[model samples]
Target chain A: MPVETIDRSATDMKAEAAQVSADIDAFFDGLLTPVQDGRERLFAAMRHAALGGGKRLRPLLTVAASRLFAIDRDRALRVGGAIEAIHVYSLIHDDLPCMDDAELRRGKPTVHTVFGEADAVLAGDSLHALAFEILADPATHEDPWVRSDLVLELARAAGTSGMAGGQMMDLAAEGQALDLPAITRLQQLKTGALIEYAVEAACIMAKLPADARTPYRGYARNVGLAFQIADDLIDHNGDTAAAGKPTGRDAEAGKATFVSLLGEDRARQQAQMLIEQAIEHLADHGDEADLLRGIAQYAVARNH
Target chain B: MPVETIDRSATDMKAEAAQVSADIDAFFDGLLTPVQDGRERLFAAMRHAALGGGKRLRPLLTVAASRLFAIDRDRALRVGGAIEAIHVYSLIHDDLPCMDDAELRRGKPTVHTVFGEADAVLAGDSLHALAFEILADPATHEDPWVRSDLVLELARAAGTSGMAGGQMMDLAAEGQALDLPAITRLQQLKTGALIEYAVEAACIMAKLPADARTPYRGYARNVGLAFQIADDLIDHNGDTAAAGKPTGRDAEAGKATFVSLLGEDRARQQAQMLIEQAIEHLADHGDEADLLRGIAQYAVARNH
Candidate 1:
């Protein structure tokens, strides 16, 4: 049965987010149970970073996208969890003193602040390894090909060309004169890659033909950009408590971002346009894609 | 036709090491060429760490193991290169000030020392991602099952129950009391896991049946432990320039190591005994296993 129908209001997405957050947390809790060794600190730090936080938007996106093809829910969640693992690892490293240096994440002290830098780094590395482990396990899928493809997809999304690469671009851009295109390209690599991987994973799981992915790619790309812009806007205007971390960091770092390059009003307009375009990519589907549509709308809507 | 024969001496293995080292470095250089984007710093750090440093013993072990089965040479090297990437990434992170806090690795400044901590972390993260990316690529193995299986094996070697978990244990054991068994288990996870994976990757690439793996794994286990003990011995007795890094770190930190627990003479003898035992695990093979035997001898021979 369909979980939610078309024309669903914003309240429906919140409920779905809550459910996904709980599921992902439970999955990590069970998966990260400390082995009978002295590595309890590592597991604890990983749990601290990965559990009980975030909107679970990436996993939610994977779940929502999987609905477009009627894929297996549990399998979809597993894929989503791997992607979120990558997301969480990046966040842990990003919040390090050498990086963003922020002490708060998810409304609490960051991993390095709570666990110290060594454990924080190892915890993040463990999570990074976990992403591939989860994807490669037969439990994720019976077909080895499916698992291998997912590993490839997620690895690319997390690697230098994707998240890490984007991070490098961001680091290099700090206090430099990055124009509109440069900032857009930087954000595309840093955040857009994983967001695209979320939906692409669903496509891979469903064994959808490569040629059939154009619309989904378009949907994912548009939504990812829209989501990033909304993030910059929130970082500009929203309070730290609401953001679960410090806000206006872009301005503080003197870094160029969507809001920096396009001005606040135009950036907001661009995000709205992208969301509409993202939804337009799903015109081929009906009620089955309602969740994705909700997610696209939610991309910009999260800031409000 | 064979690389070397059963009676090959330490000089022959050194030549082989130099060859494998060059091949792995070239592979990384080609793979890590920075995009036109300004992420050169990240790529530079990765190249600085991966390109010119270690003995490439892990990849040599991989190459040597693959020779017994006549696996595709380039494919075997790719697998070896992937394994070496993990080794390099781990070193980069381990040398961070929060961990070993060392300024030197491979006779030169460590990644964090040269590139700043943020870049160091990103470079290591990129290399970690690169390992999976290399394994998952169609070039690594034509069969998806083979690629997927390789990923599962390497991920297991690198994850919580393996390398990362071992690092956590080592961190917690600092200046604390750890007995012989605890220290053994720690080295097995921290260093042995990767060394074992080096051989396991060869078995995986050769399509050696799971049931046929007992001897190889036994060999791996013994050689890995022997290698660790030899490493500790080197740290205990060898000078900085010879070992390529600071020495006597374990005793200085009051951390119990193979050398600390077993004592200098005992650890040296234990490594020698383990190397012989490792060689015996390959008793079933004849002239084809010559390199493996040579490596077993080389493990203990390195310290001498």
Candidate 2:
């Protein structure tokens, strides 16, 4: 695309992401409305954790990928909402006392800090259950096969060999020297797995051809790695206020991160390179994939 | 049925339960075998939590229910294994420091006590994910609709409105005096929900007529309540060694339970009444449901 067209699409992508964020918020609010005899405290904590705030980038990726195939935007958003719930739940549990022990997230007190540890744990567990519930619902997709496919893929992405395994690796990585290959594999499993699922879910919804899925998968892989590298950079140099959490946590913990292993300049250069390659994977889709392409740029470009 | 037939079936039921327990253990072991370069710690913790000795009553219930419609035994076992995973995950999380702070389970060291709290949490979380994955796989059911239905029901049973919500209520009830209705509702949500799903899943697998489901639902509801009441009674009067964990914990915590509210004699009577009523719900099913009837009796009759 031309320079002017690229800039316009970037603006469009931002607006589109904002719309998805609002839609998902409303969806959760309705889903979690407290009945007279409901567990109000648990619901309140879930709302507090889920609705507090984030970029909603994963949902954006789902929506963007769905748009590439002219699939229903509303369906994509609801599925995206499920993905966001899984993401938020992971964050809640990761911040617990036994884990990272983070007190603040998204510029506010973490769920365990505000809701008490038990409630926080239950809330996170409930959110994880809710994600599968949403995906399995008929409203998410008219075809049962699609819903089942989404559930299977999402479960794999979230389970032992994927994000959870990555987390275990991270805990083990503390104070241990990890090579570049190990760190890369760790990041791929920890965060990349879910991001890849976000895009994959859209393809499933669209019933895209298997051949057509390759580019999107390649795109998602590169974008995910780039996003993590950018995150490491932010932790290394970004302000705590801007990042919405304490910075330099990797250094403080002596954790083996990409920045720690490769140095800041090389890490930045690699992230930029990955983003470029991610955009290149979208070459065949023309203007229809502009939002996804824009997201690739935004992944490494964002300060936070 | 004749008295002789009933006596013979009860013996058969014990043997059946034992077989189901062994089948589920093998199923879990096969499901959790570490892949090349897999996260061994997480897998080990999951195996520890899941494989430790228990009655495996939930899987037995599922198997017994499925047998009513002459459903495939292997298929039922796989679904039962998924249910067991969910049950084990709940126990693991409930035993975490932030929750029950339990040191022992099934007469063995708890997951957190053996593998550290972080691994325990991830194992529980990953097990939750694995439950849905198992259900969604084509191996669980040939029809995607059936798989989707199973996932949907299990998620609801495990989510905020079910097990997690009940947990929240239990936490909130710590110091508060709860009446009979509140306690009943709590138990129904926490334990009854999953038991209901266990029977309901078999119905889905069998494609049972809609009206045929009512009796099983009634049977499960009564059995669930009876099971909890029995648990409360055991905590009130049984030996800690036999129970495999601390006994009289409800009294120690001053948490209101059926035993505390109804007194020991009345509580025992209540459980017996529920078990009898539970058996009556299966009156129309003949000897095919004998195992389920035996399970109801065993729920209140067991020492542990």
Candidate 3:
């Protein structure tokens, strides 16, 4: 039987987002259950980082996209959980003393601050491994080919040529005069790659042909860039609590970002244009893709 | 046709080790080739950490074990390369200022020391992702099940239940006395887990039945323990240059280890017995198992 499709209305978008958030929470709770006679502290740190707080946007994107193909919601949730693990691990490491040097995240103490730098590092590392482990398990998909595809795409999205590489560029960009293209490229890798993978994951799960996935890929690309631009706007606006991190750090570090390069008005306009383009890509699909369209709008509108 | 079996002579062990080392070097060279107009620094850091240096013992173990089932040498080499990537990434993170805080590794500056700590962290992160990516590729194995199996096992071995857990235990062991069993369990998870996975990967590649893999698993468990004991002994003896990193740190940290829990005499005796037991596990096999047996002996005998 085909999975139930969600409508594209604002109410459905809110409901879908909440549903994925709860599913992710439950999944992580079960996954991170205490290992008796094991490294309890490590598990604790992992729980703190992974389950502490987040909007679960990547997971929502995965489920929403999967809905278009009538893919199993449970499988989509698992893949989303894996992607979220990678995202949380990245944040944990990024908050380390030697990295972002931030003391707070999601309105809570950073992993390193709460668990010590060493434990935090190990926690992030373990989470990274856990993500791949989750995807490789047969439970993720009956077909080994799909499981391998998920792992392969995730690794590409998260590895040196992707998110990690983007981070390297971000670090290198510090105090350097970067043009719009350089900054665009940096965001594409640092944050965009994983976002793209989340959408692509659904295509893989649905076994959609390459041609069939192009629109979703395009949608993801636009959403990813717009998300980053909105993030820059948020930082420039200095709404610290809403951002869940210190605002104005980008400007403080003399780092060039969308808001800094183009005036705030232009940057905001660019983000809106990207979001329109993002929604346009999903026009071929009916109301089954409504949630995905809703999510693209949410990505730009979200304050935190 | 069955793959050629390696002989058990001392000369053959040396030759096999060198051959695997060369194969891994070539594989990583091709994998880490420069990306044009991309994050060159991150790639450089990855190359420095991965191709910098090591005994390639894990890869050799992978190759030797694969030989038992007459698996393809090139396929075995690719699997070995993936394992080596995991090993190198672990070492890179282990040497971080917040972890081991070591300046030198493999007779050269550690990743964190050469590249800034942030870059080093990202480099390690990227390498870890690259390992899974390599295993998930179709080129690694024609069977998707085999690829997923490799990914799953490696993740389990490297994640919180294994290496990361052990590292956490090690950190927690500081300034606290641990019993022999506790220390043994720690090493088992940390180093032993990956070594065991290296052997198990061959079983997966060969599509051997579970029962057929028992002896190899036993062999791996014993060899893994012996390898750790030897490392403890080397550290106890203050052989810094041979170890390629500072030795005697365990003693300085007041940490319990195989050598500390059991005096040097008993520790050496234990390692020797373990190696013998390891080799004995392969008694049911013919000359096809020679290299694995040789490796067990080398694990205890190697200075580094």
| Per-model TM against the reference | 0.97, 0.98, 0.96
Candidate 1 segments whose C-alpha is farther than 4 A from its true place: A1-11, B1-6, B9-12
Q: What would the per-residue lDDT of candidate 1 be over residues B1-304, giving only the tens digit for each residue?
A: 2445544645566777788888988898899886667898999999999998887878998988888898877888999999999999999999999999999899999999999999999999999999999999988898898899999989989988899999999998887899999999998899899999899889988888998877888899999999888888999899998998989888888888888788889988898889888888887887667777888888887843
Rank list by lDDT: 2, 3, 1
Deviation (Å) of A118 in candidate 2: 0.6
Per-model interface RMSD values are 0.7, 1.3, 1.3
Write candidate 2's Cα lDDT for A1-304 as tens digits: 6899879888988899788889888889988887545488799888998884888899999999998889899899899999999999999999988889999898889998988998888999999999999999999998999999999999999998789989988887778888999999999899999999999999999887778788899999999999999999999999989999889998999888889889999999999999889988888888889999889988998999
Query: Which residue pairs in candidate 2 collide?
Result: none
Top model by DockQ, which number? 1
Q: CAPRI band of model 3? A: medium
lDDT of 1 by residue, A1-304 (tens): 2334534735667788788999999999989886657998999999999999988889999998999888988999999999999999999999999999989998989999999999999999999999999999999999888998999888898988899999999888877989988888888899999999999999998898888888998899999899889989999999988899989888988888888889999999999999889989998888778788888888897853
- lDDT of the structure predicted as candidate 3: 0.89
The positional error of residue A254 in candidate 2, measured at the CA in angstroms, is: 0.6
The digit string of per-residue lDDT tens for model 2 on B170-239 reads 9888899999999999999999999988999999887777697888989999999999999998888888
Best by TM-score: 2
**For model 2, what TM-score is found for chain B?**
0.97
